[model samples]
Target: MVDRTPCASTTAFAQMAGLDSKTPHPTSIVVHRQSRVLEIEFDQGSAFRLPFELLRVYSPSAEVRGHGPGQEVLQIGKRGVDIVALEPVGNYAVQPRFSDGHATGLYSWDYLYWLGVNQETLWNDYLKRLEAAGASRE
Candidate 1:
């Protein structure tokens, strides 16, 4: 069942626009715990299988994103992070509680689509950042 919880005011605008025309809605969302992948099929016929690690590293929470540009916190050692719970946030997003106790990210349809489309670039950039910082994904 889709949860109807009201979104925080900060995300209310996105929720309203999320239902607008051309905004693709998810037809299915499945968590493959064994594979540590989140499989999502959108109504627009696009599908993506995003790795748990990628999701955790790219979480949209304040902790990860910070309050302003260039303030993004680089996430490391999240290679093993997995979603323990996934809950709906109104009709707009899904909040995932990760095994590492990270549950603040709100994965919106638009953001998910963007991630799917840019997964390669994002992953590559993340790796580059890690290497530059001498950080390990472990």
Candidate 2:
């Protein structure tokens, strides 16, 4: 059998050194509302851009995701909304305060990177769902 147990000493050393073997961190973020895109720049100079509408709809706030799972508040009229501010949430993520004063949610680095990578398909699907529900971004 293979040795699957983690070396405690090594793990402790890595943790103490802040060397997380799990994920990479983001260096910067830029949101372009006019282009409907949110860009995330990594420490390696790699970057990706996601759509504004997708980010708005997927906002991680009680205003968007109510108290429980089924109590989600559907966001509307956020098509061309811009990111007014990007507040740092410790060293892990950023709270993108929108022009609409939606500064409640904290978007993690991993989540932001995922959003950028999957923006196109997710945004298209969101638009379709909106149309089906007779909702307009206007």
Please give the lDDT score for candidate 1. 0.91
TM-score against truth, every candidate? 0.88, 0.73
lDDT of 1 by residue, 35-106 (tens): 999999999899999999999999999899998999999999998998999999888789999999999998
- Residue ranges of candidate 1 with Cα displaced over 4 Å: 1-12, 15-17
The clash count of every prediction, one per candidate, is 0, 0
Runs of candidate 2 with Cα error greater than 4 angstroms are: 1-21, 33-36, 43-46
Candidate 1 C-alpha error for residue 49, in Å = 0.3
Candidate 2 local lDDT, 1-138, one digit each (tens): 999777999777554333455545777666675786777787756688766667778886778879888997668798777787777866666788787778888677666766777777878877887888899888
lDDT of 2: 0.73
